[model samples]
Target: MNSLPDLLRLLAVPAFAWVAWRDIATRRVPDRVWLPLLLVAGVALLFEFFTINGSPTRRFFLVRVGLSAGLVVPLSYAFWRLGGFGGADAKAFIVLSVLFPAYPAYRLLEFSFPGVETALGIFSLTIVTNAVLVGIFYPVALAARNALAGEVSLRSFVARPIPAADATTEYGRLLDVGPGRGGLDLDALRMYLRWRGHTLEELRADRSTYRHSRSLPEERNPPGDGAIRTTAA
Candidate 1:
């Protein structure tokens, strides 16, 4: 409870969760988050080093910190380079390397807290492996769901179609409706509609105001252009 690493457990849990939520909402995390975190962690670490004078105790702490940081930081960067991890995610793990360094252990009644640790005893590595397991299982779960609903096959296994009415509220790309495009790509149509601060249903309802390729905010209609096909949007 008194150790810097143990105290940081409180900060690490909620901070990581908040970052995940922010990324989900806006698709990007601010670069500023790491700076303050690294500062506080650096100060605490320096403070702990001077305050602990016992040779064996400091050596044990340094060994764990060295092992955890040595393994986790490089692996996190490698995962990011290999495209398995996002930049924010890799940075988060690197922060975890400093914040944790080893599993934070404490006692409650007859049990140990956290209740999990890897064979190598690096806390950050445990998180990465757990994320990998979840990544593997998640698609299997989705595919099982589709199979039970009789939507079997690779396409349905990977993607489930959302209604056009609901599409405006969700985040995804439109799969091109085969042919009969009438010179309109659904991707371009949605971009133009979004730029105009409107929805597909709105454009569908009043094609007269948004009937041509001229409907895009900064784009002009070319010569001999035909009216936008209603089905195109």
Candidate 2:
């Protein structure tokens, strides 16, 4: 009951759908599908070219195919770069040159038109629709993900100051330190230092002037009774 053109038209939807599915599942569309799709598009174009009456209409179809190819290739490349679509989608569009040689206008119309203005109008509308749908869906998906995960707090994003070096200091800020290993808090260390007649600010100002510095002394063994030793010059 169905004509050959009608069969081809129906076939185009499944072919494109398969391309989208394969890309979604494996991040790739197989060459088997793309190659046949390209060939089918070429055959469809050839069929349309000879079957249609008037030399002017044939030239129009060819011109539209050229324009659509030119537009779709670069635009698809941009989309691929943005992570919106993959290389397979662009190739699929190129194969569509057979089915929509004139494009947007050709897609909308059941029959060929004398002028290309209708095609241009349809192309513009298609672009606008795709843009709107992508914009709306992407943000909604991101929000849903963030809500499910529970967003990170602002305080967690900032880097805190390093702590001072001292064992006695009970640094609260360094309690749950993970990355750079823990150290004594300057404020807490200063409190401990103050108990021993020195302030933290004073030690920071001049390390060399400490009345009783807690720094470890260099090791120097005393001379043994049976060991040889050299006297200072």
- Compared with the true structure, the alpha-carbon lDDT of candidate 2 equals 0.53
- List per-candidate RMSD values in Å: 7.6, 21.9
- What is the C-alpha lDDT profile of model 2 across 73-136, one tens digit per residue? 6666677788665567656655654455543223334665323455363342344346548766
C-alpha lDDT (0 to 100) for residue 188 of candidate 1: 56
TM-score of each: 0.73, 0.49
Worst 10 residues of 1 by lDDT: 224-233
Going through the candidates in the order shown, the clash numbers are: 0, 1
Candidate 1 residue 111 Cα shift, in angstroms, is 3.5
Q: Please provide, for model 1 over 73-151, each residue's C-alpha lDDT reduced to its tens digit, 9 standing for 90 to 100.
A: 9988998999778899899889888877767777767888778777767777787778768867877888888888877
State model 1's lDDT.
Answer: 0.69
